[model samples]
Structure formats: structure tokens, C-alpha cells
Target: MTLTAVMSAPPVTVAPDVPLSEAARLMAEADVGCLPVVAADGSLLGVVTDRDLTVRWLASGADPSAEVAAVMSAPAVTVRADHTVDHAYRLFRRTGVRRLPVVRGGRPVGMLSVDDLLIDALRRFADLLGPVSGSILHDDTEQGFRSPGPRTVDTNGPESPVVGDVMSRALVAVGADASFQEVTDLLQHWRTGSVPVLSGDGRVVGVVSEADLLRAQDERAAEDPARLTARRLMTAPAVTVHPDTAPSDAARLIVDRGLRRLPVIDTEDRLVGSVHRGDLLAAAGRHATDLADRVRFALLAAVHPDAFSQLSVRADDGLVVLDGRLPRGIGADEVAHLIRSVPGVREVDVTARPSGPAEVHGDS
Candidate 1:
């Protein structure tokens, strides 16, 4: 689906010349986390997020009354309204930015926040669950409902879930110079299996897993060991995933390489989050739900409402069944083709009836 279908429109904007305090006030009033910094002609100049205000301005002891331009993130990252939601998601992962201005002919038309994508996804999930759950209730078989979609091993496919969707955002990192005890404390406190060992530049240089700590302890007991630090204990040259990495691919790397966690990094190679094997498994498990949602939402957005207002759709085990009346000149094959384009729908079964009929077409 195109970003226009999910992006929040009539975006709240701020002038680059506005006071930082006024910008913050605007964000509070609109209950938004960021504001597009636009020119007088509505050209997006930059973006100012709450984090920017806190980290770049307040933390730096900059004057609150200064122009927001002083603190705003420049060279705005953006996506065209016509871009696919998948494309926008890729941009989000690459930039590590939470909001992207949706533009049309160089003018800001809307904002696509992570929240917007999440809500859209949830609504689609609801549509998927409604019919599937209803059908499950009517069936007497012991078989459980399975979603139709490509599984995790097929990450190269068009519908693979991105790392941003499954990665753990509650980041816990240890500096390369941090003492072994400090690293242990952080791991214990976060209850995470591993921690990214970060260089002075804030880039992940290695990883310290439970195994690494145990190995270090063994070595320490074997002899009088040197002062242990993250740099010393961590396994170097970490295997990492970009935020846009496909879950299947990430899972393969984890399983094949015997990694406990995969650090998520941006284009700049800075640590953003981490994805563990369990996280990838969870994403793999949700494949059907994700595909069902994608198919339902995409078809609903593309189908002719005049002909299919009363149409109903349900997905089961990669098969899509449609029950509805078709308008004159519209064919079920055409509708089925549209549904087939969705990533996970294995087969499209459209029970189409003629315009005026109360009877069903195709299979019962």
C-alpha cells in the first residue's frame, strides 16, 4: 500500500525561524512528538523532534528562546506520498528517524510517524482476525487456523517482515571500556541475553553474550586474569542487521552463526536496537497475521466500493475466500488477481454473484 493510505495528513508544521520554546509548545498542543520545519512556501527544511530538543538543546544548555533552526535536524529525510509503505519503512530503518515528511511536488502534505504505521497495521490485523476467528468458531475440525503467507525462510520474498517490526527497542549497551562487572550488572538488570559492546563512536564493535561472560569467568579462574572489560570479553566483529533487514535473513544468520542477538544499526552504523533469536521466532510466528492483515487492507483499499460494499473476505492457510456480489463489467478473476498480488495469499477464491442475484458463484 502507498504511504498516502497510512500517513497522517494536515501535518502540524513549524517555521524554522520560530523560537524553540514555541516549537515545543506546538508539539505539546498538537500532542505530537515532532514537527516538520517548513519554509514560508511550505518546503520542508528540517524536522525537530522532542528528542532533538532534549538532547541537542536543553542538554547542551542552549538558549530556549533561540531559533529552532539551531536545533532542528537538517537535510530533512522524507518520502513522497506515492511511495509504497514498504519503501517508507525502508527509509525509516535507514535513517533511524521516527517521522518522515510526506511530500508532493516539494511541498509537505503529511507526516508518516511510526505510530501511524502501527495503528494502520493494527486496524488491518483486526480485519484479518475478525473473519478468521469467525470461521474458526464454525469449524468442527481440530485443525487450527493458519495465515496465508510466505514463511521466514523466504525473507528474499516481497513480504518479509522488517527488523524494525521485531527488534527490541529497550536497548541495553555496554561501552568497550566498561568494566566486566558493569557489563554484568547491565545484563542482569535488563534481563537480556547479550549486550552490544559499543566503541567510543557509539557504533557496535562487538557483542558480549552470556557465553562470553562464562568463558571470561572460566579464564579468570584458570589464572590471574588481566582487568576484564567489555572490549576484552566481547566477541569482535559483531554480526549486525540494518533496521530494514528481513526477519528470515536475520534468523538464518543467528542460527547459522550461533549468535544470541543481532545488533540493529542505521546507515551510519550506530546501534539502534537488538533482535534476538526469540524475537525473530516471534516475527516468524506472526507471519500469517501479518500477511492476512496486508491482504485485507490492500484489497479493501483497492477494491471498488460501489460493487463490493457488502463484500466479505477471509484468509485461511494462505487461501483467500471472497463472498460478494460483483458490479456489471467487473469479473471475479480480476478481483482475484488483485488479491493474489498480496504477498502471502496462496490462492484467491472469489464467490462472486451477478449484480442482482441473491445466489452465490464459484464454490460453496
Candidate 2:
């Protein structure tokens, strides 16, 4: 789905000739980020946000009563209503942007933001499945489920599980010293929606989402439309959740509280992991894929006595290749075919060496 599918009708806007202070006042009253400045005929001129006014114009001693056209971001990033969700993600990542002016016939129809993209991605998937399904289900942490998609369920029900269970331990974070530009680079590199803002001691200090940075820039435009700062722009008191909490509870906390992300905590309140709206829905996919993997293992075991016993599997860009020994009752070709049935297995290469007690070579 694109912004057109989920976007609201034309957002409120302002004229370039308006005073900087007046624009800021309107934004505060309306509670909006970046406004698209338009011409008399309704043609787009430039854009401004609270960040621009505060940092650029006001903080720098520029007259707030001055025309907004003096400091608005021009030729705004725009998207059509029919653009797909993936398209929005790509653009946001590419431009390090938070919002896009939706245009129809060259006229601003709506505004789209990374937050909207995140919410849409999750909400669309939410309709298909829940964190634990109709009811909470526990899963085997030691074993992989048939292979689930982004939402792999290690457990079935809403029982209090260990933090190590559902939490994605591999968290991507950034330093406060990192520039706004670099933050976008890191998030895009990881294809993540948000990254934890960490201090030197690894303490969770804040968070900077695509929306945050964009909003910051817009605020700057409203002010002087030039300066930037990470400290001033980040969202502090980061949202969090305990690792052992039930997925259902996490979902409730997020949905009811209007949160897009939650930092997963542990018994001691250390930042152990994170759980997002997408994570819950992804658990279901993981469950389905896990089931598929299980069947694959079973079939391989039944097909060849040592199908899995003697071989080591290696992955290269999502392709599974088998290496090592060709154990008793197992043929190299047969092993390849057997292992290929694994759910995530794409292509396989078999290079099996016949088993032997021992071999020694290269003597001085």
C-alpha cells in the first residue's frame, strides 16, 4: 500500500508570505510538523517546520515576524497517493526524510511520514495475525519453528517467558555525537525503522526516528533554516518493555499507548532487546516457517540415516550449501536434494568427502 491508500485528505497549509512567528503559532495550535508553503495560485513554493523556526530564525535572532518564504525547504520530497509502502520506505531511506508532501496534479493533497509508513506496515499486517494468535501460545526456544516470517513465534500463549525468548538481541544503536545524516545511513543500512540513542556508557538516552530528524530539520527551517543539533531533536525517555512480558501484553501496551516501538528490558531494567508492532505479527510467520523447517528435518532424517549427521550447512546470501563428510548410507547428491527441502533453503552445493577414521599427510 502507498501513502495515497492510507493518507488523510489535503493537510492544512500556509502561505510563504506569512510571518515566521505566525507560521509557528499555527503549527503549535494545529500540532503539526513541517508545513508546505504555497503561492497565491496554490502552487508549491517551499516548506517549514517547528525545528526551523526555533533553531534557525528565533534562536539565531531572526525576526519571527519575517516572511516564512525566507527559510523554507524548497522543492519538497513528494509522492503520489498510489505509491506503495515499499516505495515510501525506499524514498524515506534514500532521502533521510520524515514526511512527504502528497501531490495530485501538482497540488499538495496530503502529507506522508516515516511514522505513517511504520504504522501502516504494522497495521496492515496486524489485521492478518496477532502476536500470539487468537490466544497466546508458547514456543520451543531451543528449536526453530517450521520457519516463520518476520513474526516467528517461539512460544504460543501469553505466559510470561524469558527475555531471551522473543527479544531480538541484535539491537542497532547510534551515538549522540553521530550526525543526523549518519543516523539515517545507519537505519537504512539495517533497514530498521528506529535506532536507540545511546550515551558513551551504553545507557539508553534517547531515540531518533526518521520522523524526529525530519521534524528537527523543519523546526530549523522555521527558525534560521540552517542549524542542526542531535541533542535538541531526539525524543527522550525512550519507550520500553520487559523481555519476559507476554507478546499480547506488549501489543496492548503499544497499541493502546500509540507507540510504534518498545525497548525490551529485563528483570534488572537493563536494555536487553526491543519489541515493535511488526515483531508480533512477524512471530506468526516465524511459527509457520518453523513448522515447515521441522517437517524438512523430519523428511531428511527419514530419507537418509546420516542426512544431517555428517554434513555442515553453510549459507551464502540466503542460499544453503552443504559441505563436510558423506557419512555412511548418505550420498553427496542425495544429501543435496534432502537438505534443499529446508524452508529457507534456496540453492545448494554438495561437496561431500567420504568418511574415514583418520588421514595424515605432509611430513617433514
Candidate 3:
């Protein structure tokens, strides 16, 4: 798609000599996170965002009334309006600019945000098809789905168990306003990758993943890190499952769809727990022979399933490696309680995936 098709037209700007306090007021008045700083000749000199003002100036106790030329961040990131959306995507990620100024003959003509691309993605997936006609989710006989056999939830030990027995009642969802990085934050925060995107009407739009954000991050770094934003990074036309979906069926959906996590929504399409590939792995009592991978995946599945909780439970070695997702958005304490409760379990290894860093949501 062409950027002109979606770029916000005729962005506002301020002169380089404008007082920093005035620039702050302009941001507040215009309800924009960043503003273009222009020269007398209409050439772009610098750009300013809430972060620049707060982090580089305010936090440092710089004079608020200083001219923007003194505190504004430059050189500004810009793109041609005639370019394709892909060009804008490249520009944003490469420059690490949330809002890119569209230039024509060195003058700002329009603006495009990472949110614009994000909104377009959600619009594309608006009203996700659950059992839509000929939908992928409706297909049966898709292998790897195992029937839930009776497992010992309670071994007459103090701990009681099973995935269905204890998932959270609340789930945080992403909106069009949310960027790809924000989804990573949500997943890393919730300790699970892949979060459902909700429309204004509360309909499920799409899902975002670390892979999506990682691709964006890589793409941005591929060009310039300062330019890319979440909108340019998300994958659209997401598939989802209902919360009451059988763990086995959900696992099948994850496998069949080649997905890392599936959004579990109610009839109203509100988000519930994330059914990750590892979640299913734990439910089936399957563990990777790569001993450490198994124990941690199991413990997380038992304790904090919200965060991309995967326990690589090595029933033989009793060594467990715990990797917690929810990067910048969440920090989870080790489930010392759940760790001690596991039968024949020995060591616990914990690695928390922080924001901006990639976390593997599904098992290899």
C-alpha cells in the first residue's frame, strides 16, 4: 500500500527558535508525541518527542524556556510521500522514529506513525473468523492432537494440578494504539508471547508475537534502529480460539496454524489466557530430552502461565530450566513454592526475557 494512502496529512511544525516550553505546550495541544522542528527556510533541523523532552532535557533539569534548537533531537527522520508503505516501514524502523515527517523538496508535507500501520493491521483482521467458512481452524484430523488422559493432578501431595484447573481469569489485550514493541512488552510482561488485538467494539482483531516484534526490530536495525515503530512491525489477519477450547484442540490449532500462541477469547471475543505451544507440552506430560528445557517449562506451566511460562521438566534428571517471558512489561518471581512441590524435581534455572530482547515462546 502507498504511504499517501494512509499517511496523516499536513503535519504541524514549530520553528527552531521556539522555546522548549512552547514546544512542550504544542505537543500537549496537538496531542502528538513528537513535533517537527523547522528552520526559517522550511528545512527540517530536528525533531522532538515526549521522551526527548523528558529524558534528555527535563530529567536533566535543562532550562525549559531554551529554544528548541538547543534541546531538539536531530537530525530529523523524513520520507517521501510518494513512497510505498513498505518504504515507510523501512524508514520508520531504520530511523527508530515513531512519527516520520514526509518531506517534499525538503519541506514537511505529511506525517506517518507506527500506529497507522498498526491500525491498518487490526483493520485487516477485524472480526476474526473462529469457524469461518473454509477457515483453517475448522479443519479436523490435523495431527498432533492427543486426547487428555487421566493424569495425577494431586499425588496426595500438598500440590494440586492440571492446566485447566488454574489459568488466570483476566487477560490484557492490545489495541490499535498499541505498537509491536508494546505487544512484546505485554507478552514478556505476561510471560507469554502472542497477545490478542481487540477492536474498539471489543472484537478480536489480530495477534502479535515476539517474532513479529523481532522481525520489526531486525528490520529496523536492518536499516536504522531509530526509525522503526510497532505499527510497521505487526503481522495481521490473526487467528484465535475460544477460551473453553480443549487444551488438546488448542494445541492442534497452534500446531496447525504454525502459531506460537493462540488468543483464548470468550463468546464476546474478550481475551483470556494465552495457550502457548509449551502450555500444551506441559498438559500432555511431554518433556524435551534436552533435560533443562523440560523442567523450567513445566514449573512455569504450573506456576505463572500468564508469562510465556514454559517448563522443560526432565523427569529423569530432575533438572529444570525456567525461562520467563514478559520482557519489559513484566517481572515474575521464581515459583519457589511450585518448584518445591514438583515430584522428583531438583534444580531450577530461571532466565527472564526483558523488553527488546527476543524470547522463544514455543518449543523447538
Best by lDDT: 1
Predicted candidate 2 versus true structure: per-residue lDDT over 1-364, tens digit per residue? 3466666566768998898767877776665677888888886666786556654664456764789888888877777666544455556666776777777666788877766655544444443333443222224354421111122346665443332466678877887677655665676678665687777766666777655654454475555423354555577656565554545555655665567677764434355678766566444334333333333333333332123445665566547656677644346676666656656666777776866442221111
Model 3 residue 239 distance off true place after TM-score fit, in angstroms: 24
Candidates 1 and 2, the one with greater TM-score: 2
Write model 3 residue lDDT over 183-293, tens digit each, in one string: 545665565545667777776666655444433432543565334433455455456665445444555455445565665555566565655554555544332334444
TM-score of 1: 0.41
TM per candidate comes to 0.41, 0.49, 0.39
Can you tell me which runs of candidate 2 are displaced by over 4 Å? 50-63, 82-86, 127-240, 246-252, 263-343, 348-364
Error of 2 at 327 (Å): 44
lDDT of 3: 0.54
lDDT of 1 by residue, 1-364 (tens): 6777777788999999998767766775675667889899888888997667544653354676789899888888888877666556545655677788888877788888754554443333333322221111112235421211222335464554577898988768989988766776676667565788889999888888655654454344455434777898887766677776656566555554545577887766688888765565445445545565555556534432223456677788889888876644457787788788877779988896756433221110
Instruction: For candidate 2, report its TM-score.
Output: 0.49
Report the error of model 1 at residue 49, Å.
0.9
Model 2 worst lDDT run, 10 consecutive residues = 144-153
**Model 2 vs truth, CA RMSD:** 16.2
